[model samples]
Every structure is written in C-alpha cells, then in structure tokens.
Target: MSELIARYFDRLAGREDAVLTDLSGGLRRSVTGRDLPDLTDRVAGWLAAQGVQRGDRVVAVFDNRLEAALLLLAALRHGITLCLQPANAEAQALADLAAGLGARAIISAATPCPEGATPLTLEAAAASPAHPAPDLAPQTPFTLTFTSGSTGAPKGILHAAESFLGCAAAFNRQTGIGAGDRFLNVMPMYYMAGIFNGLLAPLAAGASVVIDAAFGTPTALRFWPRVAEEGITALWLSPTMLSLVMRLDRGDKVLPAGFRRLFVGTGAMAARDAQAFLDSYGMAPLQSYGLSELLYISVDDPGQPHFGSVGRPLDGVRVHLDADGRLGFSTPHAFLGYLVEGALIPPEPVFATSDLGALEDGILSILGRSDDIILRGGVNVNPIEIERALAPLFKGRGFCVTGLPDATLGQKVVLVFEGATARPEDDEIWARARQIVAQGPGRAQLDARAQIAALPLGPTGKIRRAALRETLAAAEGAA
Candidate 1:
C-alpha cells in the first residue's frame, strides 16, 4: 500500500469494530473495519489477476456503495490510479473518458463496459484471494477526478495519494471532527466533496459514515427523519439541499440531539434562507468554498460566525485575488495536474479559479463566477450582489439572476425564480425583482423573468446556471 493508505489503516488497525453502514441499493449492511481491508485486498488480487498493474488507470462507474469504497482502497493499495465516473454518465461520455485516460479496466455497476477495456464485476472481484498490499511512495497518483463538464468535456484532475489522504486528515483535525462523530454521506462519490470530505475524511478521523444513495429533491423533505434515526453528527450539504430541507415545516418533528454543525458548499446560500434556517434550527449553516483542483480552500469559523463569508483559509492554503478579482489559491493539497489524451500535464504553481471573490481581514467572500456576471452596456454586473438584494423579497423560494443574450446589450439580466403561485405574466415577482436590482450597486435592470416549478440543480446540488440560461433563451425564442 502507499505510505498514506498504510498510515490510515495503521491508525485504525486495532479498531476492528469500527463500522461502515451501507445504505445503498435499499439494503443496510454494517461492515467492520477489520473485514473492510480484507475486501480491499481481495479486490486488489482480482485486479492483479486481470493483469492490471501499478499506475494503470481503472474507470469506476459505481454508486455510493461499499464495493465502490473497497475498489478505491484496493486501487490505492496496489498503486493503481482509479478514475471515478459518474454513475448516470452517458455511455458515449464514459467511453470517451475511459479512452482518454487509456483505462486498463472498467468496473461498472450499471453501465456497460466500453470497447477495448476488460470488464470486472464487484462481487467477483471481492471473491478473489486476498493479496498482500504493496509498498508505495506518498506522492504516487492514486485518484483521477473530473470536473462537472457542464459547459465542456470534463477535465481530469490527478491527486497524489499523500496529498489526498493528508488533506482529509488535516481537515478533520482542523475542524475537530473525530471518532465520536458520525457523518452521513449524501453526495455522489464522483465528486471530490463526496469521496474526500464525506467519506475518507471522517474515516481517517476514526469516525463512522453512513453511506446512502444519492440525495434528490423528492427525498429531501423526508431525509431529516432518517438522519435523526442514524444519529448523524455532521455532513456537508449544498445550498439547494439545505433550502429544500428548510421548506419542511418541522414544527412537531424533532431532530436528533446529536445533529450539529451543518457545512454548506458548492454554491452560495441566499442570505434570507441562511437566516431562516438559523431561526428554525438554532444554528447557522457554515458556508465553505472549494474546487475539484483544490480539495478545500476555506470554511466559516464556528467560533465566530460570518454570515456571508466562507471564513479564513485553512492551514497551508494561501488565498488571494488576481488583478481581475478572480480567486486564485495555492495549496499543498492541490491536484497534481490534468490528464490530457493519456499524457499528464503539470499544473501551474497557483490555480486561478473562474470564481470572483474578495479577501478582507483574512475572510474570503465569493462574489460570483466571473462568467456568470452580466455585461450590461459594458458595465460588469455581479449576479450574486443582485441575488442577495432580492433574496429577502423572494424568501423561501428558489431564485437566481442570470444573463440572457440580447441585441442591444451584450447580455441582459434575467431573474428566474421558482414556486410561483401564478404565471410569470400575472405574478408581480418580476417587477419586484426588477425594483430590487435597480436599487443595487450597478443599477442593474432586469430585462426578463422566468418561473419554474423548481430550480434545476446539478448532480452535486449546485444551481445549474448554464442550463437555466438555456431555459431562458428557449423561453425568449418561444415568446
């Protein structure tokens, strides 16, 4: 095993009773830590039998199951690089990604094996002989994650074993999350937040995690009861997920006393919703900022609550803004580089993110994405600033400010909101939104309004602005 994986296992060696509950596939099975490594060994043996060797890339298209975690550990133990593909990814996209990585094998639970790659089953792989773990360097590449691919093809981000494991351990220690905590994993494994924060970080701290199927809006309302039942202590949630949870009137329903410390990430949470959640739950959800390239950048300090800031940078993470106000960060935990056409390209010393933010008194507040800003008559209008201004007017409802293509200006500001009681033409919400934008800094003018049943969300529970823009454009064309 790589030094990092070996060290993690060593930390929990005597804690054989450490439990990992698998709530995937509608079945609950608690596997002990002692047996978990055996499963990983069996998977490693199976990969070896399939002629897979160290540094070979293996594509995994599985959900948040025990087997998926086992496979990931096995790959790390044997020095094989594992590329996690989203379970719902299209066949062609999976094929293209696997081909681009030159994956030696594809272990899929639902998707079919792509051409030229050997297919491996989780059950069969777990039945193989338990092979001894291999010794590996700390900097060995063990994981290759991809971007959301919302606008273009997903870019592969390679993470070294030591950096990946070290970041989780450091985050856990920094946050005071230890063996006493029980985390609930709701995010998909393909995302970095899912694999690192939700699963590995908790486990590294000797804490147990409850793995469930991917969370959806339909299940959002009823999820709190299960969380209470599971005695979940902490978990990372997105703004949209928290918003959906806030919609539930938990007047009579009592949450578990152990539940505390809700961390929000992926996107900004509306100020009104954040305040409402605090009023209802007696605790403000801590907002954080991070990216796939950098595991974690900053988080709100629990001791001193900053309503809109994503808190100070974590230890060893340097955060600054470029001349364009784009957030740039350098961290030891940053990914090695992007893998392009089977070749590894070294990353820059500092990763300049598309996000625009400001750091004041060591606190980082994300303004909005640079690309999401509206260019009204050549004046850059920050959508987040406008959204914050309109949040109170549309409290408890999903709303976003996006730019739509226009002839007169480069792009016009459009307010797309959710849960309208009437049609967009009849409701006064648009006028109210326009009035709020007019009062903002840029004197932003809303050119259009749209109403949907609910805001569209990406896999990680982030608002899909590109998709919403497309929806607005389609509506304009039809009008």
Candidate 2:
C-alpha cells in the first residue's frame, strides 16, 4: 500500500507543472503536483503526532478539496486505514461509526468531531512538518467504505490499495482515458465510485481532474458551462443527473467543443432519455455497472454504445448469471471483506449481486432487483419493465413501481411519482400512468398510485426504493 503511494508520488515528483484544481466553493485553488506531496506529508506528520500508527483506523468528513485529497494520500502513505463519512452526516451516526470501527482519530473540515475520538482539523494538520512515509505490505487494508444502506444497515467494506489501484489502472486502459483528458469529478468521496473511478483512476491515467463538492440539480443546470470553462473531456454521472441536465432549456446553446464522452451508472437509465441525450448532445452516454464490493465491472464502448447495456466485462473480471438470473461477478478489484466489529469476514469467491440481469452476446442489461419484483397473484412483474414503459409519459419527472401488501393478490403493484409543485391533477396523472402500463406488458399487475413532492434520493442520486416503499405504505395506511 505504501509502495503504491510512493510510486504515484515518484511519478508526479518531476511533473511540477501538473495541477489538481479544487472547485469546492466555485473558486479554484490549483495545487501543483510538486506541492501535493508536501501537503500530504504535513498531514501525515500531524497524524503521527496525534498517536496515529499503521493499521489504526481514522475517520474523515471532508468535502472535495485540496485538503481532503491530501489527507487521503497521507493516510495511504502512513499505512493508516481511512473511513470517509459524508460531510453532512449526523453527529450521532458519525459517533456510532467511529465507535464501531474503534477509530484512533477523527478528521473534519469545519465540522465538529464526535465524542470519544480525538479531533484533528484539516487546517491544523496542514500546518505541521513533513513526516517520513511508512513501509507496508501490498495486501494491507487501506480504505474502509460503507454501503449506501438503501435496503438495510450499511456495511463497512475493507479494501487494500493494490486491489483498487489495479482496478483503476485496468479501467483506464480499457476505457481509453489517459494523459491529455480532463475529468470533472462531482461524486462524493465516501463512495467507492467517487474514490476509485472519480479520483484515483484519472490520476493513474495521468489525467487532470477538477474536483467539485457534489452534484445536484444546480450542478446539472450549470454542467455544460463548467465543461466549457474547464475544457473537460470526460465525465461520469448518474441517470438522474443526466435526466435533470436534459430537462434544462438550452436555447441556442451547444455542447463544449472538447467534450469526449459521458459515462452513466449507479442506476438504470431509461432508454428514451439515453436516446434523447445522444440526439441532443451528439454523443451517447455510455452505460456501465459496478458495486462497492467489486469496482469497474463493465463499461460500454463510446464508439459502439448499446443504449441499455452496460457493455462487456473488463479484463480480469469474470461475470455470469446465476441460476436465478442474478448478476454474479469475481474481479481482481474485489474488496477484502465486510468489516464486522473490527474483524474482517472473508467474502465469497464470486459475489451474487442483488440485481437481476441478462448477458446476451456479452452485453449486460440490468433488470430490477429480485426483491423489487412484484408478485401479483403469483405472476412475477419486473418494475424496471413497467418503469421503462412509463418513462416517456413522465419525461422530466421521477417515478418508480413497487409492490405493496394486499389482501387478495398477496402483493399489488403501486406507482409512486415525484409530483411537481404545480402538478397536474392527481387523478389525471394516475390515469395517464395506468394507461401507459395498460398499453405495456404489466397492465394486470397495476393496483394503486400515489405521489410525493419529491423522491427520496441517496447521496449518489439513486432513488431510495426501500424508503419510498415505506413512504407508500404509510400513505396507503392513512387513506
């Protein structure tokens, strides 16, 4: 792990002109490659002074900034395991996570540390002298990332530097993203996608990255302008973000000249939206699939994109469907294991993902999760099929179909939508949705409809289906 950090720094040592731009507050703070190591070393020295040692766990809550990046590299160099929590995470939740991991210290930028952990501010850490890097084994665990917990309690997944770095290098090679390309990163650092694909992968490819705090509706509206300003060549966004961007009125506007490709993942994008994005921007958004357990499973080729398919498996990854049609994969970048009570539990050789999917001619197309299947009178109804069919009707809006407990049918399919402020009549919207489903294949499965002011979304912009289901149940009970 330390050796990898050493090598990365060694490569940047002579490239003093290379820069990493931090765009947290709309103001750019450009740090040269030469200055980065010095910042990292200072943080490492502060960590060492605070009694941090190799194998010790450190919790950090920071936005995308030069200090955050420095902390990550410093932690890797000093052989300290890092657990990155969301910057806006609840105080009690942060405390619980720190206690569970037995964290040696807590680092925060402007945020207060939880009780029971030593507080190390980013400002203070950066003022310390340089500390010598540590020696560590390649297999040593360096990062501990938590799952989104959309379905249940979040699990802490432990990872060694070699595993993730190898995956990043392979991804860069397979995707043809390298040196001259500029990537704009807006994903949160807490997630594996944000850390591996957003930061490390681009750095490994010798590509410059523009780090933004996070992507939201405002970011979507301003995306093209930023691309034009930064000369960005590549980007990785979620389907929700793409939909939001497409909703904007770009009258007489054109896509930036240097823009190369856009990668979409983390959730299924409707085929209609994918096509519209391609038609409007003159470049199709390449779809891909991956999970925290294993990084960079598959990515569609930009030159020959299949709208709904997440492309073929990358080299060193073996993917196949299980007997139940669940997507299963084994990759060189698979995590060490789930961290349970400070102990590492070995994961299975092949991970059976919660998602149901099909691999036809090496192209992977994701169906909804098995748990998301609506069993209406013993007939399995795929929500994705219904959602895709209704996508066009609710063009700029958000909607999802799920099953609710019913007296007669066992489970009844219900459509939930994100209602606009001045939404059309509920009856009218429901009737239109039902009409679409009736014309589609899952008409018989439809049972009820409801609307919420806004859909519950996770940090990564994925709809929180489990939470949405709970909300639906409460609404149903009220009536």
Instruction: Estimate every model's Cα lDDT from 0 to 1.
Output: 0.77, 0.78
Candidate 2 lDDT, tens digit per residue, 1-479? 36677777765555566557888875777766777777778888888888787789888776667666777777766778899877777778777777888987777642344454455555677678888777788778888887767766677888888887788877777789887888888887666677776778887777778888688877887878888998999988888777777777474446789888788988887677788887887888888888888878988976788887888788899887889899888888899999866677888999888899988888888888998888899988888898887776775667778889999998999888777453656567678877777777555546887678888887678888888888888987998
Against the true structure, candidate 2 reaches a TM-score of: 0.93
- Residue 453 in model 1: lDDT: 72
lDDT, candidate 1, 1-479, per-residue tens: 65668778766554666557877777787767777777778888888887777778878776777667777777767788988877776767767766777887777643344443455666787679988887786678888887757778667789887777767876776677888888898887777777887888888888888888777765576678878888999988888777777676455545568987788887887566677778777887888878888788888887776888887788899986889999888888888888766677887888888899899998988889998888988989888888778776765566788898889998888777676455554367677777777876777788877677777877776788887887778877997
Clashing pairs for model 2 are none
Looking at model 1, which ten-residue stretch has the lowest summed lDDT? 109-118
